[model samples]
Target: MTARDLGLPSRVPAPGLPERVTIWEVGPRDGLQNEDAVVPVEVKLEFLDRLADAGLTTVEATSFVHPKWVPQLADAEELLAGLTPRDGVRYPVLVPNERGLDRALAAGVRHIAIFASATETFANRNLNRTLDSQMAMFEPVVSRAVAEGLDVRGYVSMCWGDPWEGAVEPGAVVSVGRRLLDMGCSQLSLGDTIGVATAGHVAALVNAFTDAGTPVSALAVHFHDTYGQALANTVEALRHGVTTVDSSAGGLGGCPYAESATGNLATEDLVWCLDGLGVDTGVDLDKLADTSAWMATKLGRPSPSRVVRALRG
Candidate 1:
């Protein structure tokens, strides 16, 4: 059955709900990239251990971006090399180019995520290339990775709307998604980069994407909580059969290109919402809250996650 068949109600029978939803925890990488004070590699390893213990099966451990762009994650190789990966858990990392891909492969990582923005402006600003150039660069990476038996996940930023380019056309997002799938990406994550998307917009865009032969099973939604609409948009996507979600612990990370944009949707918050709706994420909410609070303390800031704050209260 599709997500539409389930409908949106305030309550659902615990036994009558969908079997499960896939949650990709992105705390270790996206959560710490923008911090001014460098987080030690050991601290990063501890954080990852807590995430695994919290019942997360997929965690983005680090990024392979150049140190000049994001110095905080310069220890990507060291970090991934040290983690004692759990049996059921999958550890993935972000790779920006061929060199980054090589680094991850050397560390024996099986999952890798590549990024490109739907808007030309964001692509140029973040990736130093136009949309066409970014796609061209991804071709060889995707091809080689597939040959190596690695799973490739594609991220299309600003899928909902862009700060500079204004409301992005649905067609533009779908076109990029198609290209990524054609390049052999096993999954496509639609990123609401600036958190400007609404529930209606999410449904419309998801419907369009699924209708265009971009298999719904291969789609995941990634939203920022900048406008307090991340959860709502996620619900809309779930209703349309988009089961995979990309969220960060403690609501960490924001797009540098999208000025003043806040954190990605908090994993703690998403877990709470899903648990209440009878959706099983295999995540321990209390443990997730504890980890989020610990990271917030390390950063010397309050958590951006409302659920974490409420639970602590």
Candidate 2:
């Protein structure tokens, strides 16, 4: 039986949230990125197939960063080569720099994402670049990608509190995001890299972006659940007109570079929340939960997503 069959939540339909939201499934890449042992490429491929069968349209496939850094995803090329390109689904990969962009393009990737840091410390620690230099690095990558007729997404990490620098100013995030968009990014995913954000900060950040001429329609929220606030922050973003939310299946994955960061907002959790709110997520909650449960088995751990546990346990 489906989650709706069990009456997960009575529909309430929040007033200001968007009628439809595009959920960016980051399970394959973000969810499995930090795993200790390299998962077999076959299992990763099966995970992608399951997610597709479950109806998530925008599944982030993998990152092309050097395997030395993210060894778990070293099979990026093989995975893409084996991927069955489902009709109507978009598989976006993370491209770190020019070299990463080359790999993505060679793989025939039509959508790519570049990650930037909202704080200088994070830029140095995660990207080995100073904050100001981030633009110079991403400019060529984004510009070339867009010129190739590819959809480029910019991920602004540490949008709320930085682990080293503490609270990040909303204006700083907008400045970084505006430059990315100006350079060629069609969308920006503002990430609470350490999951320290609250609902108020989420609302303020989205408002700040809009006030700076960045439309909410072009923004997405990526929150980690370290503070038990990812779901709450997502609702706040939705209330402020943001239509895209990033989540991982089974509550897997955290920032490998950020010690304090925890697992992302789980896809099942977000789907359950949106289902109750009467927002059209276009996700099959039952099938999605099953996919998470199956992946948990593959990982030899229990699923971290609450909805998945409640439904599949």
Candidate 3:
């Protein structure tokens, strides 16, 4: 029987959730970048098209990082060139530095995201810059992107815990996030990179940001599913008035630098929760699951998403 026939996830509106949540879909870029085999440029373009069709308004398209580091997404230029931009959908690309910003400008990208590490050990290992020096790297990129009239979003990774530096402080996350907002970024996405965050920690961290003067409107949560807390943590964030959430289709992503990191909370999974809560995200769940299933076939494996397996079975 179909999910519809099964009457799965009965709608019962949650009391404190946002009336409508903005889902920041990161499948094409963050999802495919970690794959062992390179996905063809044509396939990438079609993937974007399918995501937009599935009603993902802000689909992260690709990264402009150096190919030497992330070879899988080396076809960023080709993919952008072939992309058929949708009328209402936004395609945001990841820009790593000034050079990447230059490439983004050349490709006519209107929105971009710059990543930062929340802890010192992660900063040194992932960014090759000390915790404080990393801002120097992102400052110019954010400044230039803002000057060009492009929207910039900042990502603070390792928000909850780090492999080398266990138990990240909420104040430290707020410190990094506030600086990014100070740097002209329109929004900041706090990442649970290793997926160690629980609901209580999530509440405390969101409270810290608001307590320190950052509004919930300017914050987004990106939770990894490594420890199975992604969905529960997402609910906690929603309860605290966080409207923007970052999720990947089919749970297809991981951090290359952090071996403990796992795939993002599945976009299908997020949609199911939101759908049941009567929170509007504008994503069609069945279509999204179908897209993830098709993507899984391309990778020669079953999808890791429980919702996808349940619905597609």
Candidate 4:
């Protein structure tokens, strides 16, 4: 059965849905890092291989943060070394600071991500610094990475409502997003870290950035399903001309700092939606779902993705 045969809409008459959408798979890094059990490096490699084979063009392979912070991905170096890079695939690793960037460069990484929080409280809790201080720390790292000819992506977390701050203003998100782009990030991924954003909030936020002179083309949306709003928020983003969307295979990530946070918007779920909408993701739905189901076994659980469950059944 094809996506069209499944009765999914190929394109909404609405203006924002693009002819093609880029799905940035974050299963390896964001998904596994939050797991209680440590995933072996070999398994990580296999997971990434399957994702690429399943048609994921961009995969967030790992994070180069200190093991004390994300022990599950402490084997970032070994994982990258073992990964067989496929043609037309880009692997990006998360780097929190200069130290993390140095480690990634030593591993021969050419793509990196730097993350910042939109709210002051989450910034202090997650990065151990205020917003200004955190951005200050990232300046040199982003600058150096750009100088090295690396593709850098900046993440603005807690873009909507913050667990500590209640409500986040769109202006605050735009400010940090603009700074990250100015610091040499090729793209800015606005993250709903706690998943409190609604479709309305998403549209407002994306427009705010665009109105502030940041092109929607340079933006991506990273949503969590904590409140079952990730897909809705993603649709809003798509309607706003944002072409990139971030998801974890099998809905496999949560913020360790945000106790209320849940798994990321599942890649399977996103693909299913995109397929139905007749949007081009370049991902094979069955193959993607099978990959998630397979990874779920490695994690010793059923995938949290609704599409995976429905397809498997």
The candidate that achieves the highest TM-score relative to the unseen native structure: 3
RMSD to true structure for each model, in Å = 5.1, 1.5, 1.0, 2.1
lDDT of 4 by residue, 1-313 (tens): 8433453335544445887899999989888889898988889999999999999999999999899988998898899989999999999999999999999889999999998999999999999999899989999999999999999999999999898899899999999999999989999999999899999999999999989999989999999998899999998899889999999999999888899889999998898788767688999887888898888888898999988887774
Candidate 4 local distance difference test against the native: 0.91
For all candidates in order, the CA lDDT equals 0.88, 0.93, 0.94, 0.91
Q: Could you tell me the lDDT of residue 137 within candidate 4?
A: 98
Model 3 lDDT-worst window of ten: 1-10
Clashes of 3: 0
Judging by TM-score, tell me the better candidate of 1 and 3.
3
Q: Quick one: best lDDT, which candidate?
A: 3
Q: lDDT for model 3, on a 0 to 1 scale?
A: 0.94
Worst 10 residues of 2 by lDDT: 1-10
Clashing pairs in 4: 8-276, 9-276, 9-277, 9-278, 10-277, 10-278
The total number of steric clashes, by the backbone 3 Å criterion, in model 1 comes to 0
* Global local distance difference test of model 1: 0.88
Query: How well does candidate 4 match the true structure in TM-score terms?
Result: 0.96
Against the correct fold, how does model 2 do in TM-score?
0.98
